[model samples]
Target chain A: MRRLCVHTITTKPLSLEECLVEFPKRGVSGITIWRQALEGRDLGAVARQTREAGLDVVSLCRGGFFPAATATGRQAAIDDNLKAIEQAHAIGAPLIVLVCGAVPGQPLVESRKQITDGIAAVLPAAEKAGVKLAIEPLHPMYADDRSAVNTMRQAHEICDALGSPKSVGIAVDVYHVWWDPELKEQIDHAGKTGRLHAFHICDWRTPTIDLLNDRGLMGEGCINIREISDWVDATGFTGHREVEIFSNRLWSGDQREFLEKIAASYAQLYA
Target chain B: MRRLCVHTITTKPLSLEECLVEFPKRGVSGITIWRQALEGRDLGAVARQTREAGLDVVSLCRGGFFPAATATGRQAAIDDNLKAIEQAHAIGAPLIVLVCGAVPGQPLVESRKQITDGIAAVLPAAEKAGVKLAIEPLHPMYADDRSAVNTMRQAHEICDALGSPKSVGIAVDVYHVWWDPELKEQIDHAGKTGRLHAFHICDWRTPTIDLLNDRGLMGEGCINIREISDWVDATGFTGHREVEIFSNRLWSGDQREFLEKIAASYAQLYA
Candidate 1:
């Protein structure tokens, strides 16, 4: 079955409660809530409402951004990630998505080492809390200031070094990895290794305005989402296809209308 | 010894003859002329003036855009590349930079294969004309409408398969490959293989507005231009770091002022 997951970023203007209500109303199978939306709200109440509404918590928004200029900053990030793990566990979320951080005032090699160390520091806490950590490899464009883990091969190598298939895996986001020449091969490798943890869907707009926002809706851009989804499905992982678009245009639209468009887009491709 | 090369796109508003005259006045060591500027100009006169002005024609930009839906379109592209090779030879340029085409009407995979095949088809003419075909792997943002060849590894693989080290190589643009995870490794590989042909320099703005025209001037954006140039230099591949920014802001400025800015920017970084 093609399970649909609503990433809260698609309807970021709405509150977590509003997003939760909107998801079920739009016929989404699950919801992936961002940590930002959970801010200033009762965590237990939001979690309870999600459960009461019978919405499947696919995965938590994120918990990685590890690279930091100072030791204090690094430690603070780790502490924050620990809290994120606890939040995921509280909400009955299966995985805590990690956007492994990038070059901090040091060379890339040193930054990569720090990323690994940061992940290792949080592994034990996440393990104890029964939360799977999904390391999301962002597009290489974000390697400088965003995430250093920019390739599946690199992420898999990190997982291998850690020596725990259950503790660490990867989230395959098409927006980030669609342009990779080795994407298909890496996806196959991830599938064979059972390291494919989450699936993300979005498009690369032709005239991308902003590096952070300006992401296209699934079918609006050139990425063949259906082909990539088929590859993910071939991995024998039937997880939800989370619509994780960070588009300013979409965000400004009516929340209900946006949800309806997402459903329509998903149906056009996956259904 | 460091050399100076003016990318014609810098003076895109000027006529080709006017552009040629500007290079000598600016005290530039060489010029990299684009095909668009050469479209209706007299090739013989342009070539003659290039020599008369004592300008070393470093490279010709460009001749690839190979992905097309029809066989006739592909053939037309091949013929056009042949003409470009002739033009490069006439102008005394050592390299004809090939922006290997993108997906015609299909997904990236199919487009990538066409790009490789297109290059393979054109290599003989390039070799015959004594013109080295430098495959400029554009940023992945261009993988859809511009160039499917989006990585150094992919470009190197095509060069390797073609089996003529002198006939095919790559033009490393900082704006394109600055974000690559395996950039250093690929640069080293290109160096070892004698495939580092031409080096183009530009910066990627954080909030890139237009996919094509929003490139930042060096030192303005997040790209570590010095580090990337150091890698290129380490390869023992002695080539001019050609300034190739496509900026609306710069283009709209006074032509002489724009030239002065580029010269100053180059001096700060390279001199």
Candidate 2:
């Protein structure tokens, strides 16, 4: 129960303060905050409020969109990532999940090179801030525009290319990697190399309506979340199992009910 | 132009007879007939009509849904595949493209095994009919309900598991596999093994609206179609560059104009 974390975006309708109030009541002990939830708020006060509510600030929701067509754009992305590091530090988040970016018409290999360079550019700031960057390898469906890093192997390659810095690791999100045949092996490799930093839980619905926001609740879809969670646990990953769902169907409903459902599902999953 | 092939479902509004007429007029020299198009049609007559219209019957659109929870369901899939082989033979099609199925909540490995066994079960019939089975590894997004076989590597593994039969090869659909990092290497391996049976061409739209029917025509989206086609060609795969778009947006339009746009896009892609 202590390990159960919910991303702020999971309950998008709720304010950060409301989440602080509601989540702990629902037995959610940890939280991964989306950047959106931090808008117009004092980071220090938000951090204090979250701690006062007895919630661990697990990680910042995202910090990467590193690929861009222009040199200026790439540099801007790097600057933004550095800002994210500052934000993570201010909010007392120990980690930041990166959704490495891709350009639509650009070659993926090129985008990947840019991603590596971008990460390298920002690694110093992240390290100085005492924040770790967990590269969340996005689903291949997002390879066109959302991310160039779409596999655990690719994420590992970026880490290797960046000289295997201890500050950089991977966030294993089941929504992105469950379909991968090499998932178990990759999880093992990430563990062996001490790069397994975070674990995310979500289900993939059949007849997925929207490419971006149609994720199902834990028991509502076909993903073997428990098996994947076991594999993550087998890696000695004592990290928060972050519930990060982006579902229009779920978001449009009662957020309190959604939180209750998430808690129930999490209980059944671990039980 | 000689190598341009269109799938019947790409122009869903048209009948088999209408496709035989319209496709040739649009300079589409080859046609991959979907099973739906063959419904209620005389196979011999359809074959004759296709040939008489000067359109080559390149292959059958699809014939695999092997994974089932029950043995009866699995046997039914095998039986349907056998029927597809018969249909392919009757229509003078030399190959059949397989969208290998997946069962939701079933272990992918188990589904893959069923897919292998299903292919093996129907292989002798396919061979007897001189019809090659092209295992089209669907995109990972389809890994839940569409296919457990979600990469060229998995497709190759299945082919290898089946003793690397010449009758069982692979269908390289750009829409399904363009995101794979090992795509080039896998295609080369398939070529070296004489398992490069088919080359499917379609673009992947950035905001792909529907999981099943939102495929873009060549040059309309982000896929590196020409580059992937070059990879296929490098493998000595001088097979038809089959156009297999499944777009609700396209289907609802005036199909004649859509065919013209496809022709234009194909010309630009090759030119």
Candidate 3:
């Protein structure tokens, strides 16, 4: 019943060893590993260490950036994603969250087409590995370079384009989608289609200083986290309310204390 | 054949007199007046001065912040908007742009309801003064404190909720809406309903330095302005393609040079 998951990047200051030791001790039931956190480490051993501590490996932090100007660049991205699928398999993560990319100055429609193609290219590998690929729709501010898919509707369209394969789904992030007018309907639709593979939570600061690194902790900013949770929950998504925060401010602090605060905030929001 | 208008705030360094003189010399044929540009000057005299410069008064800069925590706060916003209507009337401006506000922690649904009520409360004055109210949906970045209307569809929905009054219309700004997947449909719908009252342009720069003031100049960033403009024109729109950029970088330079650059950019994109 304890379903709180924290992204490894949320505590960037902590080493993988630190996370393995600290996360389970905090009563946190799950961990999503960022690829950077495993650099030069033995992933199979890392998987054993993580599960040995009674923490579920919820997902790999990311595996996308599919839009590129050159065919070679795009193919490289697909290769990287295939490698991510292999890593996810090794680490025993059942899912890979994708920040499907956008190229600056490239047409989003073309980038979208490329994204659809990229995902399709990797679908067979994902299915072979039994790894679900969750397309994370980033905030629109990131439309210039981070993603072309900036809404759940577009994500659904991409899924439909890919034939709604069981291995392909969506990752709902509150920081990216809280302002959407069509959120309730989109969530219900994602649920009805049984493609809501992941859920992420964070708050939007009033004067978000940096688009990439200025996320607010829950209850510290303007998002109605509880209401959004209720909407996601209404769709029968009884999975990890995964905490995926990227904050320069939060990262510089005592990461253990910061994560304790995470537990506190998640508990208070869901209380 | 000149179809370019410039927002006064785009040249923040310039006085109203400077805009009246310089905008036309650069082949910019229209201007949208921000309330701050008027200061304590006589509105009627300012209107006469603008006309004397052979410039069309496109619209009053803004008048909407409907959502507040209290009934008293909402009433105060309405009172301010009514004053804006009077100013628009006195200045001979035919339209008043509405930013239709949001509260930091308030549910957007409640803010939307308040915005609808607030607009209805002002419809009679707007109708009497013959000033159309153009709902300019702010970008999702501003949804925390600027406006709950973040999409053209939402703007159209508000117009519909208000019974599609002749005085209520939507302003399409490419900066806020270029990322929308439903953009073409929304534009076509607004046109079909005869609610597309205004069109504005700018671009989205990669590595956008600041949220509030780092807007890209025309053709300086990634928006397919010509494509979007074609969409607007296809809907039988013949109004000025207003340049409403908010760039601290551009404003800090010589404003005259900036205006010329804007003219050049417009010519390149639209010619």
Candidate 4:
């Protein structure tokens, strides 16, 4: 149906209660909440409030940060991700997005193996919990310190190695992948394998200020959001186009005004 | 033979004369001078100075930036590139690096086609002038404003389509391509196909402040420079490992101190 979702991370200053109340008012059909917002908050209340708002939980905002210098540290990450899967389940989210962690003062080759093994270890619990693990391949700039899984093909390779379509898939975020030469082909491949579980929307701004928090609004950057939307639509998987701009500029703005602007921009650039 | 080259852009504040004097003192064997530096300067004198210093002009700074909004604009770009190729020949550079221009307020798909056409339009002239056009695929972050070519695979595909090893090849830069999932495989592919023309070295800082000027010195950032150097070596590429940092911090330091630090870092991390 080409539904639109608002990722609450875009409005980092907003409370979960405020987000639940605001999304429907702005015509968003779904919400993708960050794990940081969920922490220490009442899960039952969050789940009940989200359901009461009649919003779809497209995805829970992340589960993987797998690399570690020690085995205990790595095991702790896996344990934490297991808990994150449970939270996703309780909140009725279909997918728990995994941002594969990067090397800790080590080479990329060694880190890549850690990421694959970490995902393999978590796949069993994810299947049992009935939560699809969505590998969100971050931009390559984050390949060292953030996510080692920096390409769609790499994410899909991990999924294939794990051998569980029901338990593993990928979240395609335009901000992270718009520069990829193999983007269209990879998206098409994901569609053929039914591995495209989520579609995230955000723009990559020129003269980008901050590597982590300077994501632009949809129409403000050079990304062809509508064209990407069309490609995702052609996949025949009618899911929400989740707005996930991690901008300090937007976070400092009025939450209601920001969501309104996002809705307006989405309609203008992507509708 | 393993050699060291100084990308004059790294010390852009210094004049070509200053660069020529510094190179031999710093134990550098080669230089890649920018077109702007050669624009008004006596290129014949500069070439003679390079030869007297026993310096190899590995590559000319650039020639590509071809996409334009009008036919005249496009033609002007081609003309500029022709002049650039002439300058490259005068300086005894084996390659004229090309940063394929981006879309002019258009979608990337359209911009990508323009880049292809632009390269094709200039190839014959470049070949006639005896200059190898090495496409430097910038990081995707620059895809919107700086360059449309963002991957080695994309650059190689362009070369393949153009069908001329004499006219087209790739300039592999670690700062741009270190994050690529297929980096190792693509480097191997590029080496095997003899499309590897130039290799530039730099590091990607974790909290990249400014998109254009915040590059880290080698070993200061997380890039596995040695591994990439090994890969480049395995390709039978005996070209210079040209240091091409764009750091505001380094640029602000004493030129001798900066060069010494770079030499020390190169020896410690990549030697």
Candidate 5:
């Protein structure tokens, strides 16, 4: 139960205040705050509140959209990521998961180059703030507009290009990487290189209706979550298994029940 | 115009007879027949009609759903594939494009083993019929049920496992592999090994609405069709560039207009 964490986006309907009150009640010991949840709130107070509520601030939800067409666009993305680093620092969060961006029609190779440069631009700020950045490789379906970093190998390549910075690592999300034939080998390598920063749990539904928001809950779909979880643990990763789902179906229901189901699912998954 | 081939599924509204009439009218030189399009029809008559209509029968649309949960299911799949081989032989199609298969929740490693074994079982029949088999690696998005083979590298690995048989080769589909980083290297290797048997073309729509039925036409989405075509051609692949799309949007429209557009798209793309 203490290792159970949930992203704010999982319970999309809950306000930050509501989340602080509700998450711990449902046995969620950690919370990864989405940037939207921090709007108009005092970061220090939110940090204090999270501590008082007996919940660890796991990490900031996202911070990378580094690839763009123009220099101005790239600079703007860097500025946003810099701001994210500061925000993570303010909120007492130690990490930020990156959903690196891609231009729809741009060559992916070019986009990846821009991503590498953009991360280089942001690394100094992240290092100063003592906040790590976890590059979460999106599924290939998002290779057009959402991300060009669509595999752990690509993420590792970027990390290598950046001189293997200590502040930069990867977040392994099963939804994006479970289909990879080289998943176990890549995960093992990431663990060895100290590049494995975070772990996320979700399932891939068979008849996935929507590409973006049709993620299945833990036991609701066909993913070998337990096996993947075992691999992550085998790497000596004693971190929280963040429940980060982007599901239209689950978000439309009662969030309280959703949280309840998440608690039960985590219990069964780890048991 | 000589290399422009279209799968019958691309224009789903057209019947086999209709395809025989409409394809040559639009300057399409070849046709790949989907098995469903030949349902309850005489294969010999269909072959005669296609040839007399001045269109080459490029390949049978599919055969290979090699993964199943049980021995009975696996044998059924193999039996069905054998039937597809006979149909291809009868129809004068020199090849069969395999979609392969995966069982939900089955380890992909296990599914891949089944696929390799199933292909091995059917290879003698395919060779005896003088029909080549092209392994079409489906996108990882379809890894749940469509195929465990999701990259050119994996397809090559399977071929290598089967003792690198001449009858078994790979079909390179841009839609399934455009995002792959190792695509160029894999294509180059396949060409050198004489395993680059077929090439497929289609665009990948940005906001892909449906997984199974929302493929984009050439120039309709973000895929670099020309670039991938260049790579295939660089491999000395003089095979027909099969236009294989599965779009509900195009299927619901006037297929004559769709064919006109396909012709225009191909001209603009290759020009």
Candidate 6:
């Protein structure tokens, strides 16, 4: 419970203000803020209020979509990522998760090259702002149009390509990576290289209806969450086991119930 | 087009009889028979009819669900697979493709071990029947409940574990292995090892709506089918370039039209 964090997008129905008020009440120790939830809000005040409620700002939800069809499109992504870095600084989030982008028809190797370049371009901004960037390797299902970095090895390679910059690392998300046979080895490598920056939890539903938003709660699906968490913890990672689910089913429900369910899942799987 | 083959399920609405008559007419030189398409038919007669229609029997569509929670279930799978070997022999399909199974909640490692054992058990019958078993590595999206074998490397490992038998090899499906970063290297290894039994081609739709049935025709989606086919060709694989798709949208339309589209796509891409 002490290591539990909940991403604001997990309960998409809840506002950041609502989360700042309710997350602490539910014994959630940390909150990772998605940019959308900061819509028309004072970033500094949200940070201050979250802190006042005794919640640590876990990380900013996302800040990468670096691969694009054109140089202009790629530049635009870099500009947006720069803005995200500034936002993360204002919100007192020490890290930003990256869903490194891919173009639909582009070769993944090229997309990956672009992703490495994009991260390098944004690294200076992140370093200057003291906001670490975590590349979240998405499932290969998203390898077409989402992140080209669909494995921890690919993310690690990108970080390695960028010269193992202290500001860049990998985010291990179980929903995306639990199916990987190389998961434990890669997780071990990430930890050994000090590149395992974050751990996100959710389950891969057996009949995952939607590719993007059908993530199941911890116990609802078959992911070996406890084992993966143990691996993360074995690395001496005392960071938040962030609950970062994107589920239309759970989001449509009462967010209090969902948050409580997340807490219960965290307690069962981690505590 | 001379090297072109199509799986029966690629046009799910078509009966085996319809495909037998239609595929050769469309200049698809071969037909891969799905077990479901053979219901209530005389296997020998179908084989004769397929040959009489000037179509070579490429392979049997599938014969594996090799992992189960219960020993009884696992035995049942092996038994059914043995029957599939007999059927493939009876149908003159010299090969049987295996979509190795996974139990949802079972640890994948355990499931993989069971998969290896199950294949070993079925190997004797396959050898006796003179029907080769091609281990088809399903996409990782299916790794939860559909297949524990989700990469060529895993399939190769299983083959190696079984002492690299001549009776067992790999079925490379582009739709399944396209996103794999190790695809080209693994394919090269498979070819050099003489384990490349079959090559399957299908387009992966951008917003792949359904995990099971939302495959696209060649030009309809993002997969580099020609490039993958070229890699297979580079290995001197003169065997059929099999078009295997499962599209509900295409199935709901006129199947003849769909078949024509497949033909056009093949000619445009491969010819």
Candidate topping DockQ: 2
- Measured against the true structure, the TM-scores of the candidates, in listed sequence, are 0.93, 0.99, 0.98, 0.95, 0.99, 0.99
TM-score of 3: 0.98
lDDT of 6 at A7: 93
A1-271: candidate 6 lDDT, tens digit per residue: 8888999999889888898888987899999999999889998888889889999998997989999999999999999999999999999999999999889989999999999999999899999999999999999899889988888888988888999998899999998899899999999898888888999998988898988899999998989999998998898788998999999899889999888888887787755
| Candidate that beats the other on lDDT, 1 or 5, i.e. the better one | 5
- The root-mean-square deviation over C-alpha atoms between each candidate and the true structure, in angstroms, is 2.3, 0.7, 1.3, 2.0, 0.8, 0.9
Q: Write the per-residue lDDT of candidate 1 for residues A22-129, one digit (tens) a residue.
A: 888778988898898787877788789998877899999889988888899899999999999989988888898999887532555666777888899999988899
Residue pairs in steric clash, candidate 5?
none
lDDT of 4 at A58: 85
lDDT per residue as tens, model 6, B15-84: 8889987888788999999999999999989989998989989999798888999999999999999889
Q: Summarize candidate 4's per-residue lDDT along A105-181 as a digit string, tens digits.
A: 47776777887788888778778888898898988778867888888888888878777456688899998887776
Worst 10 residues of 5 chain A by lDDT: A61-70
Q: Please provide, for model 2 over A1-271, each residue's C-alpha lDDT reduced to its tens digit, 9 standing for 90 to 100.
A: 9899999999999999999999999999999999999999999999999999999999997889999999999999999999999999999999999999999989999999999999999999999999999999999999999999999999999999999999999999999999999999999999999999999999999889999999999998999999999999998999899999999999999999999999999999999
Worst 10 residues of 6 chain A by lDDT: A262-271
For model 2, the DockQ equals 0.85
DockQ of each: 0.42, 0.85, 0.74, 0.51, 0.82, 0.80
Better of 1 and 2 by DockQ: 2
Instruction: Tell me the tens digit of each residue's lDDT in model 1 across B59-117.
Output: 99999988888789888988898888899887778899988887523777777777778
Total clashing pairs in model 3: 0
* Residue-level lDDT tens digits of model 2 in B15-51: 8888888998889999999999999989999889988
Give TM-score values for chain A, per-prediction: 0.96, 0.99, 0.99, 0.96, 0.99, 0.98
* Model 6 residue A216 lDDT score: 94
In model 3, the clashing pairs are none
Write the residue-wise lDDT of candidate 3 on A1-271 in tens digits.
2989989999899998899899887889999999999899998899999989889999997998999999999999999999999999999999999999999889899999999999999999999999999999988989999999999999999999999998899999999999998898999999999999999998999888887898989998999888888988999999898998999999988998998899999889988
Clashing pairs in 6: none
